[model samples]
Target: MSTITVDLNSKVVPAAQKIWIVHPGRNRSHIDTFESAGVVFLEFPALALRPEIIADDSLLRQRIRYSTAVKANKGFVRDDGTPIHIADYPTAADTDVSVHLRTVKHLTTRMMAGDLVIVPGRGAGGAVLFGEVAGSFFPQKSIRAAGLPFADTPVREVNWLTKRSKLELPAHLVKFFEKPPAIAEVGRDRWSEGFFDFAYDAYSTDARSWVSLDAPQYDGSDILSLVPPAELLALAVSLYRAMEQRADLTGLDYDQIIARFYDHDALAEAQMRFQSPGRYNLKDKDAKLAKWINGFVALALAGALSACSNGDHIEFTNKQAPNDPANAELTAMINMAGQSAGGAVLTKAETQAQHAQSKLGMSAPATVR
Candidate 1:
């Protein structure tokens, strides 16, 4: 296979952007209940007023009056507006009006514009939903206007990007979210970072081409486009796997490695491409390894190019076997490009020396012979 030359000018988007993982509902009733409604439900049952009562202004005022009266009487009011002693309710603490109000405020304030909210499947089986926060917090009254059922509750309007689409999370990733958080800020760490790109590509769109090198036209030549989103993410996965296998490769942490290779633009592009219909087949181990090497080369080249333009030394550490055939070729290409471009390149030995020097300053007791 011919080595695919990616255009360095191609815009890449970072995947490190903020992501909010939210459970659709607290329980089964809240989960998968919005499938037909085409909405993601976020329930706050603490706000104990029925939708119909909240919908009617007059009735809503009366309910508030009844609630105030019950609170003064140190009692409870059933959904029918019938006053009853607080001791009659099993989960009376959860029905505290103040507690409910605080929860609503907290959720609304934390969620902001441009945040991507991921709703994982309810129970063991349900479709995951990805929605962009189109609007800020509003009462369920506003949500009812959008034809949603919930009322007298607080809700943040979302423009559901994936409607009725089911996404199957990889086993590893599923385990990552096994302990569901009421709200999880994802993509900020290395382990959870790749998920956004994966999710976006799997359910986002049908277009396979990410960045086209050739002009837009019907040409007899094969169109040169950047690697498919799935492949790109797979390449990252491979690289991460390699790093995990070889501890001597680089001194940088996972986040640092991502910062150096997968810049903001590259990450953004990967996230956007996730919506494409193309899938990365993992069955072909050899082919996947080749792609992984190509991805490494691409990232190395990007680092070299940046160094060349900025007049800085580019460093890369290769801990693969000295006889590894692919390693020699990749090292040669990187060196040649860096030299031809008048950029300084650091060898593996040099990188090791630097690592040693940094460690030398550490305050460790002398080894007892």
Candidate 2:
């Protein structure tokens, strides 16, 4: 069996506030092992997900052509074995029309930044949309009808954003964007599992640095820490729809196949670096490189979380920390201690708790002692 743990650490975020979660590894030993050959670990600062609302809906509908309705089978009704549209004659199955009304209601709910929307089109012109960019790109105007077969074609999908990728997107894609469902609403019982699925499926070896394999049982007893990639490039599109915006999804399976199979050699190289001795320990020359990598991750996240002068340009401008004397010393110590037994990976809850207590200088209580 294998196990994977995701630890979320912040300046002062407590366990209650923190979003730490664990997942069972691929090979389940009674359904609670973190052993998986193909798993990824993802960490994105909460700052990136600042919530904002869509101010313009008319403009959104113009560009994405989402307001256009597509015909869907209303299903048949029988009056003495005669088929008819629900409008022609209402019946028990007529309740099905309620589903469409509910869809419209759900779509009108408050839109937020980082939310994804999709729009369908002609043969190969399906477009994805981001709610954040809708108002800007489609500012109220007569939407130039992009002559595509999409008009009158019914779209079939959900209109919402989630932190975890369905299957194609590596776990990191969702992490870099930080669109997980609200924990309070989802409840703690299933939150960890749901979050784990998001973190695991949204990242890939091609674009993300960490992979998680197994699901380890977590009792929330210890502090598990992970150093994930600091920089990420994700592709999210924006579309205009129903005087509003919607998110589009391309097949995640296609994206994953392209990254994992077609680009296997390059992705393999990236993953291999994870096992190099200097990766975990920062004392060696690789430590500087690792620091550089860490700096990149921090900068990317900071850019996403911080208000940008121009949202399109993301700058990673804080790479000079290595030159500072105090930072250099700290890096050296981290490398040294990290290379020791202290760095050895431990999975059991007891082991993790003991490690956390030791680091905090808190003596084990009478019972543990």
Q: Estimate each model's TM-score.
A: 0.39, 0.22
Q: Judged by lDDT against the true structure, how good is candidate 1?
A: 0.38
Per model, state how many residue pairs clash: 17, 54
Expressed as tens digits, the lDDT of each residue in 264-357 for candidate 2 is: 1222223211221112111112212222223222322222211121222222221222233323433333232112212111112224333323
Q: How well does candidate 1 match the true structure in TM-score terms?
A: 0.39
RMSD of each: 17.2, 23.1
Tens digit per residue, CA lDDT, model 1, 160-220: 6553233445565555445444556665553454454443321111112122111122222
